[model samples]
Target: MQLFIVGLLGCSLVLSAQALYSSSDDVVELTPSNFNREVLQSDGLWLVEFYAPWCGHCKSLVPEWKKAATALKGVVKVGAVDADQHKSLGGQYDVRGFPTIKVFGANKNKPDDYQGGRTSQAIVDGALNALKALVKDRLSGKTGGSSYKQSGGGGGGGSAQDVVELTDDNFDKLVLGGDDVWMVEFFAPWCGHCKSLEPEWAAAASSVKDQTKGRVKLGAVDATVHQVLASRYGIRGFPTIKIFRKGEEPEDYQGGRSRGDIINAALDLFSDNAPPPELVEILNEESVKKTCEDSQLCVIGVLPHILDTGASGRNAYLDVMRKMADKYKKKMWGWLWAEAGAQMDLEAALGIGGFGYPAMAAINTRKMKYALMRGSFSETGIHEFLRELSVGRGSTATLGGGNMPKISSAEPWDGKDGQLPEEEEYDLSDVDLDEEFRKIEL
Candidate 1:
């Protein structure tokens, strides 16, 4: 009887309208162009739906898909492909029916079909179960090559350096230790928001390592499994982020879930110990050579000379650069600055004169490649430029003469107000009455 009903539904043909999803939906709409780039090559897990617009079940699954996608926005990527439109993709994945769901785990080539209830909660549960199994397999030496190398005898999964998985036994020793600040997340496996924050939290941990010199840490506690630790913290909800200062009481982290916001909050804890951007008068030999020697990149800015722009103007410009440096403190890069005319040779080498004062450049010192900022000197423009270079998408050029030029150090700002030159007075004897009258009339 079940086989007969399935066959009847498969054989029935009815024209259905184009499957339109809300524009604000978190589900990534996949096509042939983006399928390979976003799915096949990505390291994260993906739950995809292959649907035909003409099928009734396909239409029915749209709302559930949106819900699950919103719930698992950051942790896992939920996507949909129009099998009716992209016939080749549908054939490649071997889709035999409408609204076919496949879980693309670590290995994109081999995907497992999802067999679960057609409800939002059921879909989320199914996807999470797959993720846990995938993570377990990778940690247990099942995947050929994994992001994390298998270390012996730790019961808990994941690299300690990246994301520390906390248990009841080690919770007190690690969290209430003698030194360092900690950002702990109390979570339950079944919680949707907890799952959504997993990836972002892991990324924030990796980045926070370099920024804070390993003085700040990010750890996760499974609330359901580790009930003792959860109770100690009086955790009434899942996905609670708390800041643990070394000698002070733990405070709740009330910030946005975005990666940038998480990093900002962590840096705020390191305010006293945080390193400031290197402010130099000139790009001297040692200064230029040491900036990017041990780092991936270096951002150098040239500001107007004190004689040209007053101390107040220069200080305001430097403030913008400092704020940006603090924002990206976790990244492995150097933040440096110099006066406009102090390093004439270096300026000529970098072509800073063409862009006028307040010019900037990011250099990959290892590759001897550099990228100049072609936008405003404000925070937004600077962030955009640095982000492009960080992702390896910015264009580059070889250093002029394939080497850095010599420079001499100049005096730092005297902290006194600058004096602008007085306007020149016209000579009455040389003034032409008709020309002056014409200029004034115009």
Candidate 2:
């Protein structure tokens, strides 16, 4: 009887430890104090999941998602987060819905995964089951390639590669020698969504290699050990992809990705003149001048040519324009600058030629209030005057990024089961606190 009791107690302790690891697997906790420095810096595979609690599809998908964790037992880790609770983060990733999946590995940033439709079993089975072709794409080094299992558990009856075990330490050996597109994924083994996307990333890597016959390279990064690299590159969100050239800087890309999209974005690097799109010609001057003359709140930045004087004037203006551009697009600049350009005559009217090189000036169309200042510029710092263009509250860029899905489509973006979730109505009053306060107080 005593022996039996001892055995039972030992079993209970083991079970308890197992339970702790399993529950913690649900999310990757990052705080100022405690962080997973090991997993962040290590050259292993990590998966990131972006989700929201209010999302019905996300709740439903949780059950089958665990199977992915089970499948990649020794190979990877899984991680997740709640976007509704993390709104600041949600905006950074442009997360339009719940349950966004991302993949990562050694010396690599994160990349999008599990984005399209898949059944419960298929989700659990992961890239191997549904995205084997993607896995193959990575292997062939083309952004678009085929898939075959080279081993490490997600086979689900697919062929496996018993040779060359790709561990965290050896992850580089898989890519360094290859000419193919290297799809190095950085992930944690504890993240479920990461696990789910692993097979897809792997299959995509392998398939791409085989198809392209070694034109591309697919690599992996365990971000746990490489936090410095991740942070330096602004990997505020998981599953980021930094496509590296043979001797150039890697650009950051993630979320809402597809095979064709990844290839197209990266392939241009091989071509000449691949920099971020630049706007050359300023808009037609006279039309803009009249509009600026007529309109209120003309925001102006010093022209780039005025740089010899210094950047304070232009940079302050650029900073404000960058913030405004988040929602208003390029046309706003044409309208805004024209109005500011007209104000130069007013500055001349005031005999203010000795004004600072970099200055921020705003004029009310109706009030014609002249408010110009010289100082350091920040995107968020000048929120007050520009925001006045909106009635009392600011418009959210999060709310305006997409159009409604077509009704004729079978799998539409309905914010429902198959479709992506719609944004919950932000409390108009809450967003506009003064209005609510005024109503109550008066």
Top candidate on lDDT is 1
Query: Roughly what TM-score does model 1 have, to 2 decimal places?
Result: 0.49
The model with the greatest TM-score is: 1
Worst 10 residues of 1 by lDDT: 144-153
Q: Could you give candidate 2's per-residue lDDT for residues 269-361 as a string of tens digits?
A: 222222222221123444334545534344554333332423454444554565554433312222233112334543343223545434444
Cα lDDT tens digits for candidate 1, 1-442: 9999887776663232574464578988888767766876677899999998878898898888899999998988999999889876776566878899998886665578999987999999998998998899889988623222122222333353366677788767777864778888898878877756665576567767766766777778788888998898899997898988777888899997644567767777776455665654443667766766767788888988677778788889989998888777666478778877787777777778734889998877777788988889999999999888876678888888777667677665677666678999877997789998999999
Which whole-number lDDT from 0 to 100 does residue 356 have in model 1?
Answer: 84
* Model 2 root mean square deviation, Cα atoms: 22.8
